[model samples]
Target chain A: MDNLNVLDIFKALSNETRLNILRWLREPEKNFPAQQAHLPKEVSIEGGVCVGDIQEKVNLSQSTVSHYLSLMQKAGLLEAVRYGQWTYYRRNEETLAKITKFINEEI
Target chain B: MDNLNVLDIFKALSNETRLNILRWLREPEKNFPAQQAHLPKEVSIEGGVCVGDIQEKVNLSQSTVSHYLSLMQKAGLLEAVRYGQWTYYRRNEETLAKITKFINEEI
Candidate 1:
């Protein structure tokens, strides 16, 4: 996104829990619990971690985590994928890189 | 600064005006009007720009600019010094570098 909306991304990241969620999502395998159920061969865990899994790690209410994930997604900091009732969220690396580059130039 | 307080830095930086103030401070001579007053050799413009000068550049009220500067300073994103009656503010390079390093390692 452009510089203007980048402010929104910064706003999304200002919260501690939300920032931690994004940082935690960086290493999904290490951070999230194992799914006992059969996994789809095509649905890679690398794509994202489910909301339930994230809440378990953060010690936050499900609703709070859900709200943070939604805000992060809205800011283009994270991407959300829904599989049934579970919503998986992960950082959008491209956007993160864009922010890094923008900071390098602008800051 | 510790990892926990980096969140405060992000919060301080979330606003456009605050971020712009920090960015503009990076090149103070270019961004602000020339200080025509008699120089104190020890008083380096490199150290910081005055709050009044920042207010002019940002088109913000004195209190608003002062408040933002205090927040940024509290966050460790900026440093402030008192020069006579004026308080001068500038980016804290070491803190900024620490944050950049943190983001590189964490995000």
Candidate 2:
């Protein structure tokens, strides 16, 4: 992505909670509960974890976590997968690599 | 700096103007005017640019520029040196290196 869009990513990552979310998503299996018990089989662990589980893990209000996830998604830091009524969130590793490259060479 | 302080740095850098300021300081000689013309020799261009010059370059009010510089200093993104009546600001290269490492390893 361009520098301006990368600035938006930085803005999204400015918040501590949002930053924590991104870190946690980097290691999904460790952060969230088992899928068969907490999520449907179709929503595999590799795909992502449900928003409600993330809300519970973060101990924030559902809307707040939802908002943070949406902001990260907009910045291309995270990807949201819709399966039935549940919205699963996962880190966009490729975009993250781009961010790392931007930091290394640009800012 | 710790992860928490790094988050504060990210918060300080969230603004476009603030981020631009950091990038400009990366090449101070290129971005600001010569010291002999605008500032005293003892002030030393290597130390930093006078806050007035930064304000002029940013096209913002003195107080606004001062506030941004102060915030950046508090976050360890910039260092402020007081020479006579002028406060000169420059990039904290060491702290920036630490931030880059943090992003590489942590988040």
Candidate 3:
């Protein structure tokens, strides 16, 4: 729960788009495709939701979503995995917990 | 711990200055005046850390610190109180807890 680290985590979650992306990841099937026919089902499941599905749900261009995901991943709020042509993203629960505890202890 | 509300809190803490302000508030006596001779001790105590003290620690202009405080207060991260000529601020623990829980459950 270092003060500087907590600040970094909070800075990461500050954006409206990144915050929404994390929320959407909570229920991937509802907010994102469970399977994309063009992509292998196993790939989607093993890798998590693809960037295209996230882009569509977020109503942003593929480049924009990709950028946002990269930023969040750098901030340690998300984990990225690639399966062939598509990239999938999921919330980083460990960092998420650390962030929550940091806020509780430091703030 | 609504998503929008959590977003607001995160946005408030996103700034380096505002984040430092919260950390300073954690140990008021060390970072701020215990009493100002020009002002009432009770006023400083009940009202919390004066804007001037915060300005000094943050190394920002009076107007800038005032603006930052106003923004954080609006985002529910701080509580402000005025007594006589000076205003003081304190962290809003309830909102802090809500934010922590929101991240744990939603993020």
**Tens-digit lDDT string for candidate 2 (A2-57):** 63387778788788789898888878778878642556555464648789878988
Instruction: Pull out the clashing pairs in model 1.
Output: none
Model 2 / residue B70 / CA error / Å: 0.2
Candidate 2 is graded, for docking, as: medium
- Candidate 2 stretches greater than 4 Å from native: A1-4, A36-47, B1-4, B36-47
Q: What TM-score against the true chain A does chain A of each candidate get?
A: 0.86, 0.87, 0.83
| lDDT (tens digit, per residue) of candidate 1 on A1-107 | 36437788889878888888888888777777785233477766465888878888889898888888888888889998777777778889878877777676777
Clash totals, every prediction: 0, 0, 0
Q: Candidates ranked by DockQ, best first?
A: 3, 1, 2
Q: What is the interface RMSD of each candidate, in Å?
A: 1.1, 1.5, 1.7
List native contact recovery per candidate, as a fraction of 1: 0.64, 0.57, 0.89
RMSD of 2: 2.4
DockQ of 3: 0.72
Q: Model 1: how far is B39 from its true place, Å?
A: 3.8
Candidate 3 residues lying further than 4 Å off, grouped into runs, are: A1-5, A36-47, B1-4, B36-44
Task: Give the least accurate 10-residue stretch of model 1 chain B, judged by summed lDDT.
Answer: B36-45
